[model samples]
Target: MRYLFAEYVFDTDRRELHRGADVVSVAPQVFDLIDYLIRNRERVVSKDDLIKTIWNGRSVSDAALTTRLNAARVAIGDSGDEQRFIKTLQRKGFRFVGAVREAKEPAEAIVADDQVEVQKVDLALPDRPSIAVLPFENMSGEPEQEYFAEGMVEEIITALSRFKSLFVIARHSTFTFKGKAVDIKEIGRRLGVRYVLEGSVRKASGKVRIAGQLIDAVTGAHLWAERFERDLADVFALQDEVAVAVVSAIQPKMIQTEIEVATRRRPENLTAYDLFLRSMQQYYLTTRESLAEAIRLAHCALDLDPRFGSAAALAGDCHASNVALGYTNDPQFDRKEAVRLARLALRIGDDDPDILSRVAVILAGMVGDSEAEIELADRAVALNPNSWRTWNNRGWVYTMAGLPEEAILSFERAIRMSPVDPLLHMTFLGIAHALIALRRFDEAIVALKRALRHNPSFLPACRGLASAFAHLGRDVEARAAAARVLEIDPSFTISAHIARSPKSPKLFIEGLRKAGLPE
Candidate 1:
């Protein structure tokens, strides 16, 4: 998004301030302050708002705040005395008084009412996630409901566009086929999107029903579909719910499709994304062999693209997983390597929520830096609140940091975001850990059972149930759970588990000991 005002273009996407044909040098804080003021130009912005936003809620001196504000003024060729572009209301707040207009991203534009312009061209799919939300058919016989259906598609498009991972095509391009009977695959080709969402909205007697489905454009397959019915009161709220539901479902489905495509690709045709996807598929299996293979694939991805932060972060996470699962023979070496890869990922992948989330968990568990890692975890969530993987990784980070209560909340949010995500069993295991830490054995047992139901061979969940049952004094059930663990992994031992999972709470290990597990 670019803001145009007074011979200056503030390019928010590129984080640049340009004047006509020249680039303007400005500090990061100054840029943020300017951007905030311009975005909220219709209202006043208090000092408290600036401090909370720019300083991340840290207190800042009045003098320091003034310095940053003044720097912003100079960058845009305005002055405190002139106050032409920015206005400071004494004892009140600041506002961007300048006239400002926003320009949509190039090749994207909104459609005006009663306007429909078809476009024709061949386009290549972008490297990142991309989608086109075609205007929904207004199945209602009433012409007024046409507005509702169009507005709902716009809401969904805006919601999806918020995630940094997605590339949403302009509404102008999509609305051309608004009333036309068109093929989904052809729309996908013209818009160059991997996925497309289409649906119909019906409004009658003060109630609205919407049905939406996401399609894998490449394979012409239905990836997800849902129906929603809501009251007409608070129409915006209903639209928001529909958007959230659709966005949440679309995200995980798109990634799963991509992962499957990558896994099926020939080795010689593998790109960095394919290797990374392959690694993620292996990483989630959570078995010793799979985790090792995930690590190998991650390293192979790094070899192809050393600056691939997601790949590097995945490698670091695999190391942490190895230590947690008792798969690594050299604990110290794994720790050191995890730390190294985490830092490298932090450097190269600062803008990516996935990398930040993975590195946060690795550092929280291995480096033992709870405060900093928690902040990093929060940053990841802040970067992309809609991403379930970030929230899931936050759960593990908080669990390892010994903040079990927070861990459970993060895990639950992740499941709510994408209930059928392939990594959902891992999230259930996280919830079980948090419950055990809280000494809620019954709840822990319930969570473990859920995890096992999802993946019966999931050793961690089985082991968790054994420990939880033992602590609850259900000796027979505890022994059965222990026997099941052994059945799953014949070489299991409490001593090795303790050595590998150094971050495990003492109570959990003690429960395992009481369960009569081999040591």
Candidate 2:
């Protein structure tokens, strides 16, 4: 690849330089350094970026990088004294100043076999476009609360995933770089994403504090950031409050992005409501113990304000979790309680997307009412088209209904809206299942691999991959994959589980059988 400058050409493939027909030979490292500079010519290429990219994350002395840069300058017919080709910023990085143009290509076609690349969808970038919600750092100094922080990120991921107009990265992909110091541009390239959100969370002395910032990944520029401090007594309100603020911040940034007047209504006071937000955060933990705490806090929120739609919705969510996780001995009683709370939430906040979505999840997942679930999900999406969770929930409904193609599109849209959510690995699994049903075995395998890349422990993805390989006549790999799935969830019985869902189609079962599952 030749990067063009006014009179100079940096040939990446040839590892050579050309200045108006004159060949300039430079050290390999020097050529790489020059090429890097030219490719990112519009902005400053920080030393950290150069070291990471050029050295492949290896440690290299700053003096060595400086030497190669100087050598590059000389080869380009520029002197350090004149400083015309490259400009070094004080305490920052380097920039290429010269204009570039392409040189001649050698007509040799060299193809490598081991390179497997997925073709990206060709879609127009939406106005006020992309975003990333970074994992909120746990400032509470309690490592155990890492789940709390992670839960917050997940909620944000779900909330944002609803927006069809915004592009969001899957949470699993973003969290892969968690705790590591990374350059924003590199994140953009690796994830093929454009925006990033970073933040920190602190809980101490009965209060929770959160600080967050949104950045343009391509330019490493800060677009928005804010800090919120609230009492832990109102913890359940935190996620929704934060989500609302984020949605507010993102709208103005999007091209022709307008916020609806009806959606802008705010509670008179949020002190009690804040506790509800914090409680809802705990609810997403989806564990037996956490559900107890979530239910307790949600009731406390109702005590504060019976009309609080968010708290009511969270109460419903807690109940749904109990049934989903098999926490209750009486499935019928548990489901009744879930349906009751969900219906109450809908009655109180029928127009609220978050509440509508919670009710829809219960209807689809617990009640097995796909038609009603789809109706609610569609309404929620229409109300808050920017919420990723809404789309994700809709995808689940489609999958349960055996509409794999519709499910695949819904999941894809959810990923585009909030690509960084950890649960998105399941979305990939859903896509694989859909592809298998469509008899597109190769595409199914690719989607499964992508799911594994995001979450190696995702059992559904493992099962899907095994089934895909088996269908493709790769029995050994298929058996190995199925074995892994069984290891993860020993009680996993494909036939029994499929039978439980009335909407499971014969086509889907056939595809799974071809993939190697035992009848």
Candidate 3:
């Protein structure tokens, strides 16, 4: 029998794992563990069951079991951070949560190594925005520059990976095709990415040039292209600049492609990742109905694949946003559920910048756990300093901790990293809040207005605008901003808002009160 999911096939009878045409090496114990999980995928397998079956009731340490489970995950090109296949159910054991299809005949029989081989594996393109950055070519004649070119590609890959919206191919997997003449179509087929970034780096005479082109791998379309030249004196800085430019150039292209794909595809045909993407679009609208729908779609994705940490994090974020904006009357229940989901996300995605930022933002926004939120935000930045979301969330953490100067700097960094980000309003809103705490009413008003310009319906920005105007003695505009908040969220109350933002300044609260908000 064989079980297939995503790009992998598990041949139980052959006792092997295969990714496309390539066989993946796995330890004997890992193979056994995977086989057991797939066979028992309908239910969670307890630790005792694992020991009883895999170890034949032998005494196994907890550490040994965890190691085997992690090994099994790594063997299948999955990770504890993503949990794309195996999922831990806290107290309950583990389950294989991928969408699996099984066949009675062994996969080896259909794709035999001998001349009798007749079958092929069908590769499905990943549902989300996916890209593979091919190894950059060394145009410089020196052989030593080869290392520099490879390092450039690695840096770009790392930077692209910081955006959770993108499904970036790992450096090791992509480097496999290095130094080889390959067709982009074949590369896309093998890698299962919709887009490919191919580039060449030339470095010599204290100068460097990096040229990149973004290709629509499916249709062989040249979507976008750019070139960057810089001094080689600071190679690392040049690499960083090039990576940022490449990412900034391609982000909107990918998002436009995603919008077209989502519009054309029927809802029934959507995958978990597709649903997650759609949910994100809805979440960005920042309207009551849209947020509710976003939460529903996020849950739908979670239902399809319970191990999807990103989906869980997004769902938790929506719940927290509801409380922060006074959209929920049951703040206590919402906060509890948000915290629970955030905790699960942290457990599964400790190293994912997006997950860490989402968890941090939701916790700090709704629960106001200053120390814990700050730690998570700092960890996120440490993990991926190039990620705009990490810096943006860190800014909020600092704001909630009353460190206005640090908050302002962090928000500025976030904007510089991803100036055209859709969530730029959130960064602006954070800056306004920080400036308000610093008693810079004029600057705070400008920042709040900027946020409102980007996202008119964002209530936090409205709240900040009202407070800033009140502090600046602009009573008419302050009252108008306060009215906008009530129009968006009729249940708006100063007490509830203050509870969500526990570290907000007393003066900021007084300004809101002066703007005629209900106490």
How many clashes (backbone atoms < 3 Å, residues ≥3 apart in a chain or on different chains) does model 2 have?
Answer: 48
Model 2 lDDT tens row, 218-290: 6777767778887777555776666666664553443221122112336543344445655645654445676
Q: Kindly list the per-residue Cα lDDT of model 3 for residues 448-519, writing each as its tens digit.
A: 889888987888888888888998889999999999989987888898877765556798899999999999
The CA-based lDDT of model 1 is what?
0.82
Error of 2 at 146 (Å): 44
Specify the highest-TM-score model's number: 3
Model 1 misplaced stretches (Cα beyond 4 Å): 1-119
lDDT of 1 at 24: 83
> Root-mean-square deviation of each candidate, in angstroms?
10.5, 25.1, 4.7
What is the total number of backbone clashes in candidate 3?
Answer: 0
Poorest stretch of ten by lDDT in candidate 1: 107-116
Candidate 3 clash pair list = none
- Candidate 2 — worst ten consecutive residues by lDDT sum? 111-120
Q: Give one clash count per candidate, in the order shown.
A: 0, 48, 0
| Candidate models: Cα lDDT each | 0.82, 0.66, 0.81
Top candidate when judged by lDDT against the true structure? 1
